[model samples]
Target: MATTETAPRRPLDAGPPPLVADPAALRAVLDGPHAAVRDEVRDRLADQSAILDESADLTRAELRERVRDLVVEFGAQGHAALGFPPEVGGGGDIGASVAAFETLGYGDLSVLVKSGVQFGLFGGAVLQLGTRRHHDAYLADIVAGRLLGCFAMTETGHGSNVQELRTVARYDAGTDEIVVTTPDDSARKDYIGGAARDGELAVVFAQLEVAGERHGVHAVLVPIRADGEVLPGVRVEDCGAKIGLEGVDNGRLWFDDVRVPRGNLLDRFAEIGDDGAYRSSIDNPDRRFFTMLGTLVQGRVSVGGAGLSASKVALEIAVRYGLRRRQFEAGTPGEETLLLDYGMHQRRLLPLLARTYALSCAQQEVTRQLHEVFSQDTPDADERARRSLESRAAGTKAVLTWHASETIQECREACGGAGYLSANRFAALKADTDVFTTFEGDNHVLLQLVAKGLLTDYSSEFEDLDQFGMVRFVTGLAVETVIERTAAHQLFERIRDVLPGGRDGWDQEAGLLDPDYQLAMLRFREEHQLAGAARRLKAGVDAGTPSGQVFREVQDHVITAARSHVERLVLESFVARVRALPASPTRDVLTALSDLYALSTIEADRGWFLEHGRLSAPRSKAITREVSALLRRVRPVAGELVAAFGIPPEALGAHDLVGPPPADISG
Candidate 1:
């Protein structure tokens, strides 16, 4: 059961009090969490506002024209193929590329997603999967928008299970050409952003067949159109307009017998020799495929960053509106309450605002990971580091995009009728970004991948501990048990000091605020979920059940594990960023925000804690109280927290927040 704090009654003549924040400190947050290449993308946004506004209201044809215009504009400005090699006409900064890519969301999502599809996806595939020859042939043109291309990986029928794609690239040794064809209608490339118009090329993915043996999926650069006309063996049809993103000419493509030189294969990992012998540099096909996929993973990070920026826009609009809009007065004569003064209103938006901050920090960490893993040639790069990059990208993309979607809706409702006005921006923001949950990678499917990664690693440990390895295994378990007991005792002692009566009862508020306590709580839930899932799956395997059957049995459990794991990542990232801040009132407020994020997250999922006896009933009851108080603490600074996103004045649709000089409400 939960209880809400009541709002204080105000006098009749009161306008909403001006609550302010440290813009300088907020600017630091806008710079992101870690010490790395601080991207100037947001700074450049002030100049792009007019272009964004121009594109926002265009018809489909005009929208297509705008996209084309932007392509050339971006290319000329050296912003198009930013993440590619320097020799290939790019900025040669992948992290900055993502940061700049995300900044596009401030204008229009159609533009952002379309940009991602062209540069990050299509050109990225050519860069990551293709060899030096392909780069020499197409890289410069692609970056210049002289050669437009599609990333033809997702078929209509095999978006999630891409390993089973029906398209084939059959090698004809006599012709020294590879013939690419879609097996059937189901294999048509669908939802391809640039395919409807302007695409001259595609990096089509299909199974490779050589000497009558089928190899796993690989990509080859195929010409789909020439001089603005569909090519001889290719057919393209528009996806026929949708709910939003009208600017992108999304289309479907069906290939009949497209032929390209064998050299066109993007064969960085696996290759076909001149003698027609198929071979891969990496012996493990799974490892090779995953590695290729990892190179293109910048798309996921880009999408998450875009979602984060959109969340900021939404929160700024809603919070600013909340500050200015006044409603019914039940207390003082003639006085109407500012929307944020209501406890219910704070409960609704503050937590979501908190989530946006958490996501902002998490996305920054992911950006650092992306740079660390992708920048240099790390032949001996730790496998864990790469997996961490990919997994974090996947998990953060799923979490933040969903957060954006949900937060946008809540913001819309919070603003009532104004949110529905097309000019207000929320309507467009909601409609356009609705697909981010499914784009790049479907959030649900991507989350499952995160869980699978955990399970795969966990299962490997179990598999290695076969009967012959029992002695080592038993010793490991004994060591783990002892460690758990020792750790638990230490935690209990810490909790005792915080307790008012020294172990007589809990200092529930102090316990909740303690970073150590929060981490331990989050750790326990995630480990509990992972361990439980692992045990269930293992039991099924031991019972001689089919592996697929075992997987299906624990699928939901693993999803829960995945969510818990990602939530822990956000909270941990939040705490780390809070700790890194120089001590000041700004640090203190951010610390409170960090606590709100953690405690509110627990409050939402309190059932699990209660069910597992991880939290006592009395402590659980305090979770709500503390969370309510946090909402109050965060209330005064909500607008400034969002302003930290550095959204340009033209990009933000609301005005009340900016009209007043931001005050130092951190006091």
Candidate 2:
């Protein structure tokens, strides 16, 4: 018979800690290095009447127009120019740009997506992928929003597999022009933001052909609209009324041999010369393709940060509601207990809060890493470093977006009937963030890409290979099965010494709370999952299994390894932030929250731990109790924790649900 065992609960009278964290201190920590940018965005959102007003009453056309105007307004204010270099009339601060975009997630997501399309995707392509000629002519206009554009990369048949896109850009030597063609129906660019309306041009991804030979995929600047009219040889169809994000105009596009000057090619990595000869600094086509794509890493990083911000907004709403919305009279006479005081409610919301904090720390780290990589005089020269950045960006985007989807839905449920009401903002939040999981790159595919990078150790040739080829490569490849300890080795070692038998030692509450122990558990799981995946691939290949079959069978394991790797990275990032803080009530509170996040992550995957012998049944049970205890410790300060997110009340758009501000229960 199947059975469930509940951990013994601590008494309700246990209460909260003596010192509660100051909301301002926590806000400083969460705001991270680009606090000024976040604050600026908050200030802007507070005054945006169209966005702050009741959007439900607006028609789709009204919503789209409002969002469009907002994007143009933001661009005029230099918000869109933050990521580009100053030579093109930009602020030349990559981190600040991403921070601003991320902060925008607190307001209407339609505005966020529309801005991303114009600035991050379209302008970014021109800045990063195009050389001096293209930039000198178009970039200033792009940043100013005078020349709106779309990143026309995904085809009807190829979404993530850009290398396989069927659209072609054939160099016409006689006319000194490039003919861009959608070879078939499948080659049509689909779900392109700004394509249905408003875009005057597109940075089109097409297979570049010169002298009857292909040079892989390359981006070309093709004009799609002129004088408010669709250009010759161009066709567009509106993808009207989507599941959400109606404020952004998404549509499909087709090119029937559209011709543009040969000089319109991006040409940063690969290009066609005046004599119709294909030229590139990178000889390998695969490397060239990915290198070109890698320059857009900011898109992934910004999307991840934006997704995490959405999670923050959702958590804040749920947490604030949980603090004031009282239920059955379980405590004093005639007075109902606060919803957050209940064990189940705390279990539901606090762990999510801890995770939101953890991911926020991780987002800060990734953003910093991105700034370092792109700020270099020449960012793409270091191939391995570039690939590493790409891998981390992919993993972070996948995990953060998936987390956003889960957290928003859970928050909606936690608020119960109030959340179900459209005016509370959960409906829009839930609908809008649903696409984040599949944006930039689909979570499943992105995770698999992460796993591939791990198995191959970020090998330069790995991106050159397809799925079957990847399986073949991993079969004979030597793999790293051990966890590489971070710079804090001594701290980790001390924690290990506490458990006499090194991980096998029965159990202790202090040990479980140790950051080192939490990291060790997460690291073990990641390493074990990765090693197991490698062994499975080797066995399948050695037994003469077909390469495709072998890969198909092990795909799930590969994704699991990738997810484990990302989860560990998130935890390590959180622990590092907590370690850096000076001793204070804020630090103490964050430490407990970090511990809760770690334990909760482990508890969720305890079955896997027990199967792998890293944890016993009773030890797993102890983790449950510790998580509950941590929840109670965090519950009283829950309001302050959410307050630190610094989301403007106007942006929250749920004033009715969150009625009057309650007194701080932390005291």
Candidate 3:
């Protein structure tokens, strides 16, 4: 149980760059714009994290008990229903709900996900897809930790394809009840968290049938367990151990003629009438299904936000270690250089730090949109905004989670052997979050969702998004590299730069800082590639290919287009945030980090820009050079930037782990 307490072998490195590394200052940056909610949750977790941290030695049963205790604690604080309506025993502050969910990642990932499944998925379904009847009856208990439940949506055969799940809920006209059944093994709910032990009820999703009419996928609450016993006709099996999140008791469930009151149907969008007929507010089944699932978008955003938190925590640990872990002498003989002083180490971790900061900013925007979309009545909500929020949620979940995976792995490597040790936190952080790329929804599938939104006249879909506003604002800019052709804009600038000199429309420093420039390039990439992909898809269809085949032909392009949209979202969000900070020297450092995030992302994707003539070769080269320069500019503030993450000192681990007791030689 003893952790390696690494101690500093020598004095600390010379003063870091001027950006504040004060825990409070760095924490302020990590907390983003909503400091109050973010800090409240963060400080709460920091105070009570011991109870939440899962150790390697705990058995599955032990972990489950620990998780249960944490759930009780969360419920006691009313966090279980923070996003639910105040009328339904919740605070109705969706933003605070999301903040609390994301903040839990600073402790244990298992606990983080368990909280998500219980509150975000289970409670959210009742609150979002159900009417007054379900809420008035179950909301208080669910929020009070008196009714632990599972969200049984995914099946062995339909992990991502919810529409095709074979689980059936047939109306029994004579009894005025609904009978839920799994046709076979493939239809059993797979990976149902809380099912193995704690869950007593479930929000079961199945294809509902009334009068032989099939309703796509609908959720209905079914009693699965009572008095600590599995209900009749309900079978549950533990998923057992996993590579990580052992503290979460994941399991599978099967039902055989599980009957519930017909009112069990969460009939917010659709319902069955007493006359044995099916009815719905929305006529189209596809749209109705999407509308139902759309209410659960906060889960995806929460997962993505959790991923960011994990990354921030990992970076804080590694970068803090790197600042103190000394290696072979470089400039001064016998005076070892700090790990962070090495450019190689800086390259390994700093950009990731910058990227995490960018994602934090983007997540803030997504969380805000989530609050705005769900805090009010559905009918009065903006359809455009809803779609935009879904797109952002999908894109952010896909991109940010992937970023977390990459950042965590890089952080481990940057810390060398110390990162691999259990005590140091890297192993736990990486193992627990390794599933992030596939969490909530598979990254590829999520990206495809965003792509579908873009191909469906994205200009209109994104018109309400800030990215579009930035695009319009950038119509005229002090762009760098004028007279050089990239595309339409370049040609226009070329005409204006007649017989060029320094007077040409090139201002490298100013251009990189321009919000107009960053957003325009990002939007241009998104629009152009989407248009190309659409053309390819249309041509494939015209050639008499199956719709699925046509989609497959341009799948990669579809993913690329989605990536562009997400990158634009991140860049726009970061810039807007940086620009909003009060004027100060620290603000300048943040602005530099924002610029680094933009330029580095652009540099990574420059080949696409060059291929599409969006960025001429020279301009593309300029982006790389600028990115390198920003890396150096950011180096001095690297410690401060990561310090801003505000990971507790204990989690940061020791600078030089006390070497394991010198070889027990001379036994």
Best by the lDDT measure: 2
Q: lDDT tens digits, residues 20-106, model 2?
A: 778889999998888888898899998884475656888888888888888998999888888888998999899999999999999
Report the lDDT of model 3 for residue 241: 76
* Residue-by-residue lDDT tens digits, candidate 3, 9-58: 11113322444334466567667556676666666676666643346667
- For this target, which candidate reaches the highest TM-score against the unseen true structure? 2
Cα RMSD for predicted model 3: 8.7
Residue lDDT tens for model 1, 59-111: 77987887677666666667766677889878777777877787777766776
Looking at model 1, report the run of 10 residues with the lowest lDDT sum.
1-10
Q: lDDT score, residue 157, model 2? A: 96
Worst 10 residues of 3 by lDDT: 658-667
Reference-based TM-score of each model: 0.89, 0.95, 0.88
- Candidate 1 regions exceeding 4 Å error are 1-20, 33-40, 43-47, 50-57, 378-380, 458-507, 654-667
Alpha-carbon shift of residue 213 in model 3 (angstroms)? 1.8
Candidate 3 C-alpha error for residue 24, in Å: 3.3
Error of 1 at 536 (Å): 1.5
RMSD of each: 6.5, 5.4, 8.7
